[model samples]
Target: MIHFPEIQSEIQFLTKINEVELHILREDQIYPSISGNKFRKLKYNLEEFSKGNYDAILTFGGAYSNHISATAAAGKEFNTPTIGIIRGEELSEKIAENPTLSFAQKAGMKLKFISREQYRNKSNPEFLEKLKSEFGNIYILPEGGTNELAIKGCEEILNENTREFNYIACAVGTAGTISGIVKSSENQQIILGFPALKDSGFLSDEINRFTNRSNFKLIKDYHFGGYAKVNNELLEFINDFKRQFGVTLDAVYTGKMMFGIFQLIQNGFFPKGTKILAVHTGGIQGNEGMNRKLKHANKTTII
Candidate 1:
């Protein structure tokens, strides 16, 4: 596993109204090669595989998945062959042309794709058996890199963060990062999730894939539009946040939570003078994907 240097800071936002405290937990500080939530989630998947004496690592992701990128980096760092099972049939026709797929291949990893329906059964035993038949003995990790062992490693992130926080918030795509923080922290802290997508009742199912119970709520309205989708408000907030705090907020994940936090504060959801800790789950590399999805958001205005 690639170990990143510790990065924790008390950031003061120079807002037009007043300063907001965004306790930045720099997962990026971990390592540029394998940083962010992807690293946290995959760390223990690797651990589990090693403990089991597995030959290689096999996992899932999309075109611009941080999980895939980090898995490639980690597998390479650990001297393990990695296989990426991507989504969609477009991969079959022109597999190498896809930038992410290409990068996965170039990184000494193999990239393969299946039908959308097949992708649904990725967690099923039969599909896993099929994978084993083809690749020989290998380790299995779920998509979004969410697994029980992964969440266990994620807990360490919060333990190492030296900040006294009243509320801890994070952008939840798979709920692993949020769950890790909630299950690891003291009872005095409350965890909140800002989903980056729409219609996320299925997120509960994903949570069940990890632990039985957790202290967290998914604030669904902040999605702006949906996963990878963004609006003018989100973009404006991104611009303003960068201008104000000298920190970059990507539209896919952190941008959604940052804007949602502001709106929540305005709506009297997060009261003033409360210490709020925001986990910057780094998917900043996916900002290019965000640019594409923003075009479909329908309400266009200057960011």
Candidate 2:
């Protein structure tokens, strides 16, 4: 049996902003490697794998994908074989220089790199059939690990301790985490999602597909550039935030969300006396790889 650690993420109070009680749901503390929403998203999937007759677990991700890192760690801990279908073919030869890919490879995840065009066809029937042929009896987890089971696992993120909050904020990637948050949220609470990608308006449709609720809103201005893209301001905010709160926010997700949350608060987005809970959906593992890129470009790195 695959035993999951009990869901006991601490709700930490950050500070008061315009009379809004700003707090953070520290999902990042759930584990050392497979922390935050990654743990929630992968829980049931791994459990199903443990129960089933599968030869290996396969998933897709970019070079610095948190899903890839978390899935690799989980596969290692659970003693299951894993295969990572990486998006960039060029990265195959550069794995030694990439921390995320190197960690996944060290965790026994077979790495398969594909061109961007081929990766775009990942959900295509023919592409899936070819993958099945290449890796027999493999259980495939979608890119970002967002599926029905993942949504179900994410529903557990909110519980009695979080019921009193007036707003819940989380970083939106594939929309699975917020969908589960929207599902389990009280009717009076508003769920806010900060997308890390530009032109991410379609995420509303994605979230609606999982749940029929309408209490959530997407804050679209904080993406900076796009997925995995960060600016010096963001990097500085991340470093300053860590200095102030002692909480490290990953650049890809939580950092952007927290930055947006602070900006919204300054703009008086929330009513005075409202309670806001921001979910720290961890992606800190990607920092080392990101810093490597930044250092290569002679740019600022996350501390």
Candidate 3:
């Protein structure tokens, strides 16, 4: 079995003038690379991989995907080769400029860049056959590493300490983490999800496929344009947040969730006496790549 230390999250109360108490579950402190929800999602997956005879593992992701980076780091730790089927073929020659891809490569993940159309066919039988022929027998992980096993791992995120909160909130990515949390949450506790992508209403159905719990709300107003897209207001919040709390949030996932949580508080979405627990799903490593893009666009960079 792959060993993972039990992480005890520290709860820091939000400094606000309301009667409601807001606290952050520091999931980012779980591990350096496999920190936050990634650690939970990958725990069982890596253990399963360790028992398999597959020589390599293949997974899908975009330029700064946390799943891709975590898989590469896991492969390196377990002495298994990894193959990353990257989203954009144009990123092939720009590896040097892409921090995420470069990190994967240095961690020994052999990258295979494909067109957006091809990437969409990642799970197609023909695509799997073609990849198997080229890379030999391999264990495949879905995009974002979200699966039944992954959700099972995420179910352990909350414990006795979190049961008292009126609402538990997190950023929804592939919906696995939220699914796990909803499944484990008490019937009286509300699970709120803040999607970092626009038009993510589809996540409701996707999350339902994992568990039948209805004690949840998908708050969709927080996405800053779309996935991986950010503006100055969001950038300023991220920077100011770090300075205030000393916790660096990734612009893509956790930052958006935090932004939404604060906005919701200010907008009176929650009752005055409501006690909220906001999860900090770590993806801070992607900040480097995001900063590169920001610099290229002449936009304010995220810290």
Candidate 4:
């Protein structure tokens, strides 16, 4: 049996924001690679994989996907060979330029590159069949690893320690994490999801597949132009947050969510004495790659 390590979740207070007392659920401190929602999302997936007699595990991700990095680390520790089908065919030859891909490769994940057109067909029967033919019989984990099992794992994110918060907030990606949060939350706790992407219309349906509750909301204004897109304001906020709170948030997810939380508090969105909890979904490793991109664009880097 594979022994998965336990992660410590703690609460940190942000003091005041328009008389609102903010708390942070430091999910990022879970582990270096398998941290935050990635660890929560994979907890049960790995167990299911181990139960089956699968030879290797295959998953999908982009050039800087936190999911890709975490899966590679999990495969390494669990002694399972892993394959990452990365988007953007051109990245196949430029692995060195990408920190996330380089880390995955070093962790022993075999890399495959396909065009964005083909990647869009990743769920098609024929496309999956082709992958099986090439990689052999393998356990397939979806991009972001957001299946039913993943939501089950994520449900564990909230526990007795978090029951005091009136509102729980998290950065949304594939919606699996927030869906689990919504299902596991108390009846009075309102869950707020800050999407890191532009078009999150599909998240409502995807989340509904696993949850029947309407206790959650998706805030879309904080995306900062879309996925992977950043600006000087975000960089300043991330660096300032690191200095002030001693937590480094990735520009893609956690940073954006925190920014939105602060904005809402300042705009008088929350009640005066509302107690809010924001989740820190870790993806700090990808910050190096993001910093490199910012440098290339001649913009300020995230510390």
My TM-score estimates for the predictions, one after another, are 0.86, 0.98, 0.96, 0.98
Q: How do the residues 4-51 of candidate 3 rate in per-residue lDDT, one tens digit apiece?
A: 677778887866636777889998887776778888988888788778
- Quality of model 4 by C-alpha lDDT: 0.91
Question: Could you give the candidate ranking by TM-score, starting with the highest?
Answer: 2, 4, 3, 1
lDDT of 2: 0.93
Report the C-alpha lDDT of model 2 over 167-272, residue by residue, as the tens digit. 9999999999999999999999999999999989799999989999999999999998998889899999999999999999989899999999999899998899
Candidate 1 lDDT trough over 10 residues, lowest sum: 9-18
The lowest-lDDT stretch of 10 consecutive residues in candidate 4 is 1-10
Query: Given candidate 4, what's the lDDT at residue 262?
Result: 92
Q: Relative to the true structure, how large is the alpha-carbon lDDT of every model?
A: 0.74, 0.93, 0.89, 0.91
Indicate which candidate wins on lDDT: 2
The residue-level lDDT of candidate 4 at 125 comes to: 84
- For model 1, the superposed segments whose C-alpha errors exceed 4 Å read 1-20, 92-97, 160-163, 205-214, 292-303
- The RMSD (Cα, Å) of candidate 2 is 0.9
lDDT of 1 by residue, 31-149 (tens): 66776787778776776777776777899888888888788888777787899898887876764545556666778788788888999998899999999999988888888888788
The runs of at least 3 residues in candidate 3 whose Cα sits more than 4 Å from the true structure, single-residue gaps closed, are none
lDDT of 4 by residue, 197-270 (tens): 99888998988999999998899999999998888999999999889988889999999999999999999999
